[model samples]
Target: MCNYGGGLGKSLKPFVEYNEPGKIMIIETPQSKSAQLSACWGPIESARAKVRGAEGVIVSGNVRQVDQFQDAGLPVLSRGIAALGPREYMRLGSVNETLAIGGLKVDPDDILLADDDGVVVVRQQELSQVIESCEYGVKHDEVVLQAIAEGSTMKEAWRKAYDLLGPPVEYARPFRR
Candidate 1:
């Protein structure tokens, strides 16, 4: 789900209406210099999202009520937090549309995996390939770690692991040593 807007007033209804189990919500606010520094979501919205079965939420803008979001057990990733509400500072623009977030293009239904490290977007069409690559990477890492534990130098361990598994696939190269 992708929402292009500045406020949460009119947008929340449609956001709830389109709710689907296990779907991540991606919201984008206007990037103009004059845009208000108000929150796009708060504790109430977080509770509503959890009840509606949303997997998580990613806001390309601010959110408020930090403690309440944690209390509601909702995983919300936002650019920042604001004390002001959205009512006077923003207006709804669009929903379920393409959005440019942090210089990456995000479309509805794209797979978003986020953690303390950061967020990674996997296009729907590349899901299988990405999964396969990830599985292989995990196994490869284990082999390298084992070699290192057995007293092999870091470079030697990496070389031995590479020999055993062959070079990683192109997409998985960046993750490998």
Candidate 2:
């Protein structure tokens, strides 16, 4: 979701194309000075829908409606601020136009991975592998957390996490919307 409701400039943008969650969607409308479009998606609404329940939102583009999500503490990863907003800056440029988001090529159904660290997109074929890896990492972290709670040193906790997850998968894709 790009552009909150501020409405500034940059009119004529992509229209509402897709609404499915847990999938990657790219925007290729050229690189704006700031990929910040604002959240027209309505953060609270998204929460109600429970889109991607446990998954976080990764906006290679922009996100507005900050207050809603900010209050709820929902995870949203985007480029920058969008004072202009959607109504003014956006015009349904193209639905499913294969837009470039933060320099990442987005295709429908691509898996999106957003977390405390940041957001990243994975190919459709590679999506499963990414999810599995994330789960593995999460479980590993849990063990380390418990160890720490049990008075284990930071190094020991990290070691335990490492031992459980084996290794972390580095995201090789570059982010530059």
Candidate 3:
């Protein structure tokens, strides 16, 4: 789930109101390309966010105390890590607004799915379609795996799966090899 917000910089001011359970906090720094900016998040904030029920965090800028973040049980994806905290170097920005992260435009309420692989954003309107496609892909993979387990070669497995499941989804076909 995704509930978009910024204001991750160091500040005495509290942002508790913006916290929403089961939501991922997406933060973007103003001058993200510059090395001067301090880490937007750290261990303490990670713990706090988790207490507030945040599923995870993603920062367009740097972060700190990565190990502590893991200890806090909050999954955080950041550009990099910084020794310095955001105090003095940066301040909280706006919340619940559109953000540009790595050339992708993230809007409020957009669904964010992340794992060791990476994060993928799905527009709110496209959620149902994306879920359907993913379900189809899982079924297709099951068929392929079953075929391969039954002594079929890789190519044969794919062919058998395709014959049983039809062609791969449009978006996934080009990568099917």
Candidate 4:
């Protein structure tokens, strides 16, 4: 589930108890720089979250305890790292609610996909379609790469793949929001 904060005090029990295991923990702070007073969470809390079965955490603000988190194998994606703690600056703000982070509106249960490339959010209803498209793209790219390896020009390989796979049915439509 999602949690919102403005950096006040420390009480994450509600979030831990409410969040489902294997789901992402998204912590949204204010957009302004001044509001991010300290690190949102540290090693202790990361451990707590791991024990509770959280898949990972995405913080709009800063985070700390990088080594400890890495050792614990807990994935944490944040704005940056910090040494300051959150205990003195954060309090429960909102839980399981919608948040506008980085100009993107994120709602609870939205599919959050994060990898080395970055993060992408897919609405729950669009998950299946997105997956299908991704699978198709992967297969198509595989063909293109194979063709290129066999000495075809990049443009020729792309043309051959397109000719074989045909254009996507949704190519004419705008992307789903």
lDDT of 3 by residue, 3-104 (tens): 122345535235534778988988766553454356867888787888989889887778887877776678998877888877553566567777777677
CA RMSD, predictions in order: 3.9, 6.5, 4.7, 3.0
Q: Which segments of candidate 1 are over 4 A away from where they belong?
A: 6-14, 33-36, 87-89, 172-177
Give me the overall lDDT of model 1: 0.75
Candidate 1, which ten residues in sequence have the lowest lDDT sum?
168-177
lDDT of 1 by residue, 1-177 (tens): 545454454655567557687888877776654444778788887888888899888887888889877766678988888887775435566677777787887777678898656778888888898898887788789989999999999999889889998888556422211
Candidate 2 is scored at a TM of 0.54
Prediction-by-prediction clash tally: 0, 24, 0, 5
Please report how far candidate 3 places residue 105 from its true position, in Å.
1.0
Instruction: Please give the lDDT score at residue 129 for candidate 3.
Output: 76
Which ten residues in a row are the worst by lDDT in model 2?
Answer: 1-10
**What TM-score does each of the candidates earn?**
0.84, 0.54, 0.80, 0.84
Model 3 CA lDDT for position 127? 76
lDDT value for model 4: 0.74
Local distance difference test scores for all models? 0.75, 0.53, 0.72, 0.74
Q: Rank the candidates by lDDT, best first.
A: 1, 4, 3, 2
C-alpha lDDT of residue 64 in model 1: 89
